[model samples]
Target: MPHLVILYTSQLDGETDMSALCRHLADTMLTLRDEAGKAVFPTGGVRVLAYPAAHGATTDGSGDHAFCYLNLRMARGRSADVHRRTGEALVAAARAHFAPLLAGRAIGLTLQVDEGAEVFDGKFGNLHPLFTPP
Candidate 1:
């Protein structure tokens, strides 16, 4: 399971479209594959969402800066290398997506990958079949 969440400051709202960025990120993740060429993340399990921060400040408490934080959460069991590669890919995607917004402003971009409990519970249905081959 992979869930991608993008958190950005409201300052960039008029400069960029967060919803479209989230879709681009999700599509990028879906294109990633393991060494064997198999999809690294399940197509049906990919989820991306964006949230605009109402109020935020920089390290010096300056409200003039903007920030974009990406959080990728997935089930545990993948190797460290896998995690690193995935993070790199996603961060690159984020950087490219926000390039225009970063041209003239001080924007802080960061990516975090969280490996959650492997024993978590969930129920998924028809979505799986859509991605499965006959």
Candidate 2:
């Protein structure tokens, strides 16, 4: 399972091409790795998802609003605060990276995180450390 998953969609326009979006996403992933390196999550482990706009969706009819979503998964043993922080980081990354492309356009971004039970030694199943004492 990936620690981070970033999903982004933008209006297909002259300014916002798929290649540019991909590059931006890649840069964001690098930034994420750098940030994670300073923290507990494994570095260079962030995974991003690419979701193209719905079929036949056009920038003219759709009003050129980009939708970005990010999802993160982490060990359940950690506190909810950690997950919250991760979500914030993901949001910040989107805002910082896509701000230029989203300029003068309606853009929406969301973040969701799932916390799973911690697996230790591969023999024991997920034991939510937050709920159960070690």
Candidate 3:
């Protein structure tokens, strides 16, 4: 399971298009491949979500300093190289997406990929079927 979650400051909500960013990230994830050339992240299992933080504080609390934090949670098994490439790709995508806005405002972007041990895992959905080849 791979879920990319984006948490952004509300200050950037007016200039940021969360929907577009979500699509951009999901599309980027689809392009990642493992050592075997197979998709690193399954298309059907991909999930991207963005949330605007209404109340939060960033470093050097100044005037409307915006921040976007991206966290990708994926299953553990991939090689370190694969994870590095994936993280770099995702971060690059985010930077490109916010380039124009970055020029006009002060924004901080942080990204990290986590593969934590889960005691219990459960998934129920029909979306996976839609991505399967007929």
Candidate 4:
């Protein structure tokens, strides 16, 4: 199977709710199915992990590095387009929820795939990608 990681960074902290944000992203992931017409979650085919910015990770309006990170898992046969679409969906979600605070800041969203030895070795592991943009 292929694994996906989505990293989003924001500029505001006090106004954000990380738990709700995680739920929203999780729900969104559940709504996406593969070409085989299978539900991604609860079938062992999809998994999502969300992370909110750590307390004191940033300060001041200009120093805030508030972020939400999501990791997704899917079958290896999935295409990059599918991953891209998923990333776009996350961006849209962010825009709807945090546009005002993120506006004019260094907000970013990125999606990536992981196909490691374990992935091809018919075993699942606990590896996830990290936010890479500075």
lDDT of each: 0.85, 0.55, 0.91, 0.52
Per-residue alpha-carbon lDDT of model 2 for 35-109, expressed as tens digits? 335444533443455565554443466465566666666555555565565566666666676677667767666
Residue-level lDDT tens digits of model 3 in 8-124: 998777897889999999999999998999999888999999999988998887677889999999988999999999999999999999999989988999999999888999999
User: What is candidate 1's lDDT per residue for 1-134, written digit by digit as tens?
Assistant: 69998888887788888888888889988988777787889998999988898877777865488888889998887778788889998888888888887788888998999998767576667887898889
Candidate 4: C-alpha lDDT: 0.52
Worst 10 residues of 1 by lDDT: 116-125
Candidate 2 regions with alpha-carbon error over 4 angstroms: 10-38, 54-62, 117-134
RMSDs, each prediction?
1.7, 8.6, 1.1, 9.1
Candidate number with the higher TM-score (1 or 3): 3
The reply for model 3, stretches above 4 Å from the true place, is none
**What lDDT score is found at residue 127 in candidate 4?**
38
Estimate TM-scores for all models: 0.88, 0.56, 0.95, 0.54
Which one is best on lDDT? 3
lDDT of 4 at 43: 27
Residue 110 of model 4 has an lDDT of 43
Clashing residue pairs in candidate 1 are: none
lDDT of 1: 0.85
User: What TM-score does model 2 achieve against the real structure?
Assistant: 0.56
TM-score of 3: 0.95
Candidate 4 lDDT tens digits, 9-102: 5333356665566567666766766567765433233445444444434345575455555555554555666667666776666566667656
